[model samples]
Each structure stands twice: as structure tokens, then as C-alpha cells.
Target: MEAAPAVLTFSPSSSSPAGPRPCRVLAGPAPRRARALAAPHPPRAVASSRAPLVVSSPPPPPAASGTPATTPAHAKVDRSGRFCSPRAARELALMISYAACLEGADVVRLFDRRISARREPGYVFDKACLLSYNHMSFGGGPLEVGTEEEAEKLTSQNEMDSANEAEVLSAPPKLVYNSFVLRLTRELLVAVASGWNKHVDILDKIIPQTWKDEPVARILELCILHIAMAEMTSKGTPHKVVINEAVDLAKRFCDGGAPRVINGCLRTFVKDHVDNTGTSQAAESKA
Candidate 1:
């Protein structure tokens, strides 16, 4: 026997099985790398064609209870470097005179009282009346205009002027008027008082019989006449302008044919008194 081939033998360690033991898979969580590789991806969002909705904030609530809303006073319009216009003074004088006539009191004293009268506590004068006062709203014939655009422009301008005049007239005498306006108003009041006394007899002759019978109803018209005559007598404003202003006042304050009647009366006054006075003065100067 040839020396027998040496047989190779393998030995196993104490902790592990010998030779090709089946792959020992321990029952435990998978490795982090293996789990990450097996995870699924989320889907992407789709694009839209619809418009986005917009949300707006709500309006503020009204004022608290017991608190009244107040209107702001309008600012005075300064014209020709004057705070108040002569027209405004004339309007104020007319109002004061009308009030005096109603109360059967002295116009100057009434004016002083009005100027000095105190405002009530927490009293807010409603200037809305002043702003909304439209002379045309009182009633008048339609305006003659060439076109709608022209009519609109004219109407807008007239409204602006009327509102401005109303603001000036409505303001307190001590606050709104400058020295010139105050002096002018005082002089007008004095002239009205004196001229009224002097022209009391003349008014009867000029006014219609119907008006004469109802003097109470015609107080405004009479006041207009007195103011116009007083203003004319001062020789400050032109007689034509005075007459026009008087007619306008009648149109604004009086109804029906008052404007026409006022115009006729003013013309008559100019013709009878102003022209004669001028003629007599000129003759005296020449002599």
C-alpha cells in the first residue's frame, strides 16, 4: 500500500456552526440604507387654470350710541382780497331786516343781539342746509341755454356761487366778516333804518294794492325793497347792480311774479329818485 493520501479535516469554532451553515438572518429591523432604498416617492401637485379667490376686510362699524354725527363747517371763500363780499353783507342785512320786521324791533339792535348770541352747549350748526340751498329749487322759469353742455356748465357755476354766498351769509357775523364787511353791513343797516323811515310814504305808492293789504305776507319783499333803496342811496354800488341784486333776492326768497315786480319797482325808483337827484345835483354844480 502506497502511503494513503492524507485526508483533510475542518473544525468549527464554539460560537458558530461548521462549514456551509445556512445564512443566519437575525430577526431584527432592517439596515437604514436598505429601508431608504425600498421607500416610495410622493406624487407632485397638478397645475390649475382657475383664478384665485380674494378676501377683503370688512368696513368699520358706525359711531357708538348717544354720539351724534356732526357736519363740518364750510370754509369761507376770499374774493378780491376780502374775507366777505358785499353781496354776503347785503344778504345778511336783508335777513336781519326781515327778522326785525317780524319781531317789530330795531334792526340794529337785533343785529347786535344776533352777533352776540351764544351757542348752546354741544350745539353743532347744520351746514347741510347751507350747502343744499338751491335758489332754483325755490321755483323759477327754465334757463335759456344754447346746448345741454352749456346749460350744465352754467348751472354748475351758478350752484357753486350760490353755495359760496350761502356759506358766507350763514357764518357768524363776528367771525366771518372783516373790518370792511362789518362797516359796510353797519352802514347798510343804518341806511335801511333811516331810509325806511323816510321812504315809508314812498313804499305805499310803489307797492301793489294787494301787497299793501297783506303787509305781513309781503315782509320779505318789503325788506328787499328797503335794502335796495338803502344801498342805492349810499352811492357805493351802482344802481343797476343794486337793482339786479334786489331782483335776484326776490327770485330766491319770494314766489310767483315777485322778481318781475321787484325789477319794475327798482327801475321806477331809479327813474323817479336817483335820476332826479343826479340831475338836480348836476344843475346845482353848474350854477
Candidate 2:
């Protein structure tokens, strides 16, 4: 049989968030066998289409009752060979939001500048802006940053102090690079801000009851879930991919047993959403 066309692959280093991630430029097409190694974010293929058709989101469902939710068997796979993760985008967003709360900096402008500096893939940048803007809109303030926020503020002040006073005052900040990512990011920010509460309520329904009792205690966990909901509801990402991403984020960042909590809650959330929206056939077909 003729081989599938080869595509260049660049896998990001899972260890270093800031350091330059090594790129592996493979020459041959990937071997097609029983799938084992899988992509982290599987919706990249759908997102890659130049003129993508997004599934319009259904009206937000009412908050949960005691119904048991089922977990999906397998994660959906998007074979686009993307190296970007939503983690960087999320971290940048949180950082910008915290900076806004601490120093009153312009969050949008700061985020735009950071995007240029980071030089992330277009999809990753787009997802991060969408997730962060949605999270910011829902809370209407900076996420709880604790010592991290303080540390960031101190660093900024120190840099400003070290700069030549005349140079700092006279030199205008360089113009932001108007990349496709920036344009999409701005568009997402505005749209999410406009219907903030609507999206927030949708996510609130998806959160587990245990977490719901003391939402403040698990702020970051809830924040990640909110991002996943925004992706599933508005972006038309597969439910399995959304849940897997949420579970993976919890395992990476949240405390022990966090994966179970996130997975269970998201599974139930997906079940409820699918049932209400009558998208089981669509979801299953993807699986």
C-alpha cells in the first residue's frame, strides 16, 4: 500500500515551561498501526481548518442533581502533530490576571505582548486566550495568586528601578506583533466578556458537588474545569478530549487525588451535557 504522506513533527518538552523546547523534525510519515502514543490535545485537526465550522453551543444546562455520571472509555485523537499545550497559555493568562490585580497593568496589552515574546503555535495561543479570558470574565477579577503574585510584582518593580530613568520615560513601548493568534485572542476576550455570566453558570453546573460546597478551597481546579467547559460548549471540541485534558491538567498541577475528582466531575458533566443536548451519537461517533 502507498504510505501516508509524511508531516514534520515537533514535540514540546514536558519539563520546561519557559525554556526553549527541543524540536524533532522527523522525515518519514508516522507509522500507522494500533494507536498507542496519542496527542495531548486532539482537537487540533478541527482547529487547523482555515474555514472551520464550529458547533453552536446549546443553552446552558441547570446545575447537577445526584445522578451518577459515566466515564468515557477512550480519548479522541487529532492527528495534526501539534506540540502546543494549553498550560503555557493558561499560565500566561493567570500571570497577566494576577499582574493586573497587583500592579493595575493593562491585562489585554500585557497578554498580547507576552504572546509575541513566547512565540507559541497559533492553536495553543488561541486556546490559552479563550480559556483565560473566559476564566477572567467568570470571576471578574484576578485569580488568587498568593505569594506568587507578590513575587511577580516585586520582580517588575525591580526591573523598572534598574532601567535608566530617562530611557524608561522617553522610549515608547514597542508595538505588539499583530499575529493571527493576537487577533483571535482579542476576539475571544471580547466575546467571553460580553456574556460572562452565561458561560460561568454553565461551568458551575459541571463542577462536582463536593467542590461546589467550598469552591474557594479548590479555586485552581475549578478554574481548569471552567476552561474545559468553554472548549466543549462553545468550541465544539470532543467531550472525551475535553475531559482528558482536564484530567491531565489536574494530575499535573492539582494535589493528589485531584485527577479522580476532575475526571469524575467532568465525566458527569459530559454525560449531562450530551444527554440534554442529544449529542450522544455525535460524541460516540468521535470516540
Candidate 3:
């Protein structure tokens, strides 16, 4: 028999002679454990060497209690960007006339003095007052600011109005009037001065006995009537407009039934003077 082939028996501890050994996958968790050991640890948050970016927002403003919030009423302005509203001019004229009545001075003269008065030396006007000016006070009312943009707009408008008001009502009255306003005010003052005696006679016939008895107390009301009559007689403004303005002035400056009394008085005056004049003109045209 050929030499018996060399038989090799391998035991667990015996090393087998081979060119390449097959990989033996672990049946249990050994391979998994090895993988776990080899796997990288998840990244951890570390303190940055540089300053970290931070983001923050402003705190919400405290809400007011009780009062309902309302937006501030915008003051009416003309196209000229000045406080030259006819109403404003009327108000100024009324104020001047009232002052003249109190001072017993000429209305135009008083206005001229106020317009020409010099500022005191070393007197600094606080511009910040315009921005910080708040018509509302603590417990006064609530403000309705819908958005940041709206709030900014409102604030800007309010500051502008405050500046205008300050200029108009400053000590010695530094009014920034446009040409129309200046002319209208001067005309109103001139009309008032020229027609004072005539309107006084008319008012004696038209005004109530109570007003007649207390002319000193009714000076403002009388001034309104005088302005309306003078303006109407000039035929520059419509009688209806003049009457309406007079009624509005009375409503603003007078208390209680004064507005109604003024309204009625103006209607009577218009009926007597305006209507009669129109009727006469019509009759003359027909003739």
C-alpha cells in the first residue's frame, strides 16, 4: 500500500496551516460589542472659545386696565404743511379778538405786537418737549398702537403737531401762518374793528336781555357774533359758512345752551340781512 496519506487532526488549540483563514462571525453579542467599542461617541456640546451669538427681544409693554384704547385723533392740516386750516385761522382770530376785548386795545395792534415781540436772551426752547409731549396722563386713557411702524408714525405725527402747537401758542405767539391765513386773519381783525359799532347796534336789537344785562360775561359770545356779521357783510365768505363758523366757535368756547342761542341768533341775522339783500337784488333785477 502506498504510504498512507498523512492524516492531520486539528484540535481547538492546534494551529492549521492555510494560505487564508475564513472569517468567523461571532454568533452572540461579541461582534456587536466590538462594533460598539469601535464606534465613535456622539458629538458633545462644548463651550466656544469665541463669544456665542445671542438673540433677545424687548419685553412687551404693560397693558392698561379699565379704559379702552383709542388712537389719537390726527389734526387736520392743509397742503402747505402749515397750521393754516381755516378753522385754525378762525380760532386765532377769535383768540385775538377776545384778548383785545379784555385788554381794551386794538385787535390788529395787539396781534402785531405779539408777532413782533423779541425772544428773551439766553432763553433756550426745549425741543425735546415736542417729542415727549403726551396729551394723555396716568389713568388718563389707553393708547392703541397696532404695530411698530404705526407707533413710529403716530409718534412722528404727534411730535410734529406738538411743535406746530408750541410755535402757534408760544409766549408772545410765534404763529407760523401761510399767506392765506395771514391775510384772512388780518381781514377778520380789520372787519371786526371796522364793524364793531355797527354790530354792537345790531346785537342790541338781536341779543337776549340776559346777555344784554351781562355784556362783560358775554364778551366772547358777542365777539363771535361780531366776527360773523363782519365777515358776512364783507361778502367774501358765504353767509352760511360764516354762520356755521360762528356757531362752532360758540360751541367750543361757550358753555351749555350758548351754542343753540348762537345758532338761532345767526339764523335770525342771516334771514334779516342776507335774505332781505338777496330778495332786494332779485326785485331790482326784475325791475
Candidate 4:
């Protein structure tokens, strides 16, 4: 007998496998949403089941197309063929922090003809005190607040050099503690008080932590330890060892100014420390 007019039928997949049986449909175009489905009635079966309620998911949202977001750029000093180590980055930041504090002392030196002609670097204590708010530092306010009273106190001390060693002004009064090593420089202390506020912002933007664990806080601690070591070692005359130690320490801990700073701080510190000791030893020791 001739085959009865064949009704449209769907067949199971040819490669032998166990799965849901096939469904047959008249050959025609899939409906709008049906175009996405593996088979026509699967969702209907799921909906019918008393065992659990189920629903088919809609398609995912498309991604937005555009330029990517801006991010902070860190300066990486190359170490041989490779990028700097985390230790190096930390050192660099610390050096920057140190300089930023004192660089304010050169607030006058920082500018040249363009600015100098306009006005003398203001001698106003407001400018110095304002550096307690270094644009680049970790902290915002100067560790030493720059109130009129504070400035007057420091100015008075500077004038009274002959009365007593105690009376000699040690530092301008507005100077505060270094956030990292906590000794003191009139310039540096102001810088640090400024840095204490700015540090977080700087690290967050440019210096990503070396690891999840090795954060800026750790770098700061290491810097402090190295500075402390430099201070203790500089007690001897010559201070070359003091400078060396400072450099070595900065390399291991801080991120920026290991070399030049070691030189400056050692020279100044040796002169002060030795002179205070009232020793002729400095000349011989330096030689």
C-alpha cells in the first residue's frame, strides 16, 4: 500500500544517547521567543509539573560600549629588565613623602621667574602653616597647627638664642611628628602632618598594595624602623654609615627618596649631633 500521506514528525537525535524523547511539529518558522528554545514544549512541561515550579529565563542585558574609566598611574623605576619590586615602590613613595614635607621649605625655591616677579613667596605663616595641608601628602593639616599664637611662640623662641640651650629654638613651633619615622624636622614635620591626610589618597590612586596583605600601612612601619635605625647609627662621627644605613633602609621600606635624602639628613644630623656633643671629633671623623 502506498504510504499514507506522511504527517510531519520529529525524530530523536541519531547518535545513541539517553535524553528526553523528541517532539514533532509541522514544518514552519519558530515563534518570536520560541527561536531561543531547545525544543518547543519544554517550558510548558516544566510549568505543568507539580513537583516544582519553573520558568524560562529571558536573555541577558547587552554590555555598554565606550572608553574605559580613568585610573591613577604609578611611576615604576625599572629594575633590570623588569618592573620595580613592591619594596622599591614603597621606598619611592616614602622618599616622595619625605621630600614633599621639606620641599615646602623650598617653597620659595620651587618657583622661578614667572611667579617670583609677581610677588615674593609670601612670608606669611599662613603659607607655611597651610603646607600642613600639602597637596601631595597623606595627611591634610600640618601636624603643627599654624595659628597666630603658634607662629608667635616659635618666632619668640628663635630670637632668644643666648639665654639657654633650652631657649634656642629647636624647630619652628608648627612642626609635628613624621607619620612614618616620627623624629622631627621643622620642614618635614609640617610636611608629614600634611602627608598624614594626603597619604591615603596617594596610595589608593597610584600605589596599589603589593599584595592583599602588604599594604601602605606596612610600608610606613618599615620606613619608621629604618629611620630609627639611621638615627641610632648616626650618633658616631662622620655619619657616612648613617647615610648608608638610611639608603639601605629606604630601599627596603620606603618608596621614593632613598639616595639624596640619605645624604642630606646625614650631613645635617651629624653636624647637629656632633656639635651638640661639643666635640672636635667631627672634623677628624669627616676627614
* Candidates ranked, most accurate by TM-score first: 1, 3, 2, 4
Task: Please write out the lDDT profile of model 1 over residues 251-281, one tens digit for every residue.
Answer: 6556678889889887877776665432322
lDDT of all predictions: 0.54, 0.38, 0.52, 0.29
Residue 52 C-alpha lDDT in model 1? 29
Query: Each model's TM-score, in the order given?
Result: 0.56, 0.37, 0.55, 0.19
lDDT per residue (tens digit) for residues 91-133 in model 4: 3334433232222222112212112233336532222222221
**Candidate 4 least-lDDT 10 residues:** 37-46
Question: Tens-digit lDDT track for model 3 on 193-221?
Answer: 66565556567777888776555666667
For residue 170, model 1's alpha carbon misses the true position, in angstroms, by 6.1
lDDT of 3 at 65: 95
Report how far off residue 183 is in candidate 2 (Å): 6.6
lDDT of 4 at 133: 18
For every candidate, C-alpha RMSD to the true structure in Å: 46.0, 24.0, 43.7, 33.2
Report the alpha-carbon TM-score of model 2 versus the true structure.
0.37
Candidate 4: where is the Cα deviation over 4 Å? 1-238, 276-287
Q: What 10-residue stretch in candidate 2 is worst by lDDT?
A: 33-42
Q: Provide the lowest-lDDT 10-residue window in model 1.
A: 24-33
Steric overlap count per candidate: 0, 0, 0, 28
Question: How many Å off is the CA of 54 in candidate 3?
Answer: 50
